[model samples]
Each structure stands twice: as C-alpha cells, then as structure tokens.
Target: MAEHNLGDSHQVFDGEGKTFTINDKHVAIFNINGDLFAFEDACKHMGGSLGKGKLEGNLVACPNHGWQYDVTNGKCVTENECESGCRVDTFPVKTENNEIILSLPE
Candidate 1:
C-alpha cells in the first residue's frame, strides 16, 4: 500500500464530488459536511467522469447517463433500474490538522 498527502481539507471542501486524477487513476475527493469521501472518478453506466456530475448530499449523478451512486456505500439508488451492480472504487481518506491524505490500497 502507499500513502499520498492530497492537500488541505479546506481546499476540497468547496469542490467535493469533483473528479481529479491521482496515481494514474481518476479520483473524486469530496467532503460532506465534515466527513471526507473518495471514489473512482468514472460512472458505472457510461464511463462518465463523476467530477462533472451533480452532488446530492452523499449521492452523485453521472454526467453521461444520470445514474446515481452513494459514495459512502458505493451503491446505486436509481429506482427499479436493475443495474449491473457496478461500484466506484473507494479509498480511505483522513484529515489531520486540516491536511488531507488518501490511504491507497497496496
């Protein structure tokens, strides 16, 4: 596993659920209220980048097809729309003294 310091917690507070690239992978780092979230940048439906999607609390809509996902549990919330059971890859995030960091899996 590897660890990388992203930046200050405040830097991402206004840009939560926005997509960005990290370690050759697209990552969307966000802060909900005071909690931190990290997920794969792409949407399961059409490879749309989640950064361009709209945020609805902990859920975000895919820019390509309007698919929704809850970042905390990586689950789909669209009604009666049997999905492929895809989920955004999530990473553990932490804030220490306002410094943000990602705990990447090995």
Candidate 2:
C-alpha cells in the first residue's frame, strides 16, 4: 500500500466532498462530520465523477445516472438490481497535523 498527504483538512468542509488526482489516479475524498473517507472518483455505472456528486448523509449520488453509494464503504445503494453488484474502491484516510492523509493500493 502507498500513502499520500492530500492537503489541509480544511479543503473539505463538513458534509462536503472533493477530488484529488495523485499519480494519475483520481480520488474522491469526503468529509462527514469530522471524519474523512476516500474512494475512486469515477462511478462504476457510467464513469461519473463521484467527487462532484451530491452528498446525502453518508451516501453520494452520481450526478449523471443517480447511482448512489455509501461513502463509508463504497457499497452501491441505488435501490435497483441493475446496480446491485457495482461498487467503487475505497481507501484508508486520516488526518495528521491538520493534513489529510490517504492510502492507496500499491
């Protein structure tokens, strides 16, 4: 696994999300309450940018197709069988010295 220092925690406000490209990998980072969650930026159904999606509690709905995913675990919660098996990759995230840290698979 590899770790990256994304940036200041303030970059993501409570109940908001942001996108960061590291090593040519697009990552979506969300801040819910005071905790951080990271996942692949692209949605599985149509490659919509999850980073720019709408956040409702811990779920983010893709703006393109309305596919929602649980930000806490990357599970598809779109309420349909067509997307029952769809899921995005999630990464470990934390904060240190006020900087957001993210871990990706090596």
Candidate 3:
C-alpha cells in the first residue's frame, strides 16, 4: 500500500467531496459527517466524474447519468439496488493533524 497526503482535511467540508490525481490515479475523497471516504472518481456506467456529483447522505449521484454510489463503501446504489459488476474501487482514508491521507493499492 502507498499513502499520499492530500493536504488539509478542511478542504473537503462535511457533505462534500474533492478529486485528486495521485500516482496517475483519479480518486475522489468525501467528507461525510466529519469522516472521510476515498474512492475512484469515475462512474462505472458512463465515466462520469463522481467528485463533481451531488451528495445525498452517503450516496452521490453522478452528474451525467444519475448513477448513484455509496461513498462509504463504493457500492452502486442506482435504482435502490446494488448492481452486480457496477461498483467502484475504494481506498483507505485517514486524517492526521488536519491533513487528509489516502492509501492506494500498489
């Protein structure tokens, strides 16, 4: 596992998300109720940018096609169901001294 420091935690406010490009990987980091969750930024159905999606609780709706994903676990919740083979990759996230840290599989 490789870790990358993503600057201050305050950069991502509660109920919001931000995208970062680390090691050539596009990742979206979300702050939900002061907790952080990281995952791939691309939507599975149409390659929409999840970082720019609309957040509703733990789920984010894709701005392009309305596909929804649970930011907490990277599960596709479109149509109130977890579609098989329609999940995004998730990463480990942490915060230290106001700095957001993310882990990526190597």
Structural similarity to truth (TM-score) of each candidate: 0.86, 0.95, 0.94
- Which candidate has the highest TM-score of all? 2
Weakest 10 consecutive residues, lDDT, candidate 3? Answer: 77-86
In candidate 2, what residue range of length 10 has the lowest lDDT sum? 78-87
Q: Cα-based RMSD of the predictions, in order?
A: 1.9, 1.1, 1.6
lDDT of each: 0.77, 0.92, 0.92
Q: Which ranges in model 3 have alpha carbons more than 4 Å from their true place?
A: 80-82
Clashing pairs in 1: 1-106, 19-51
1-88: candidate 2 lDDT, tens digit per residue: 8989987999999999999999999999999999999999998888999999999999999989898999999988877634556789
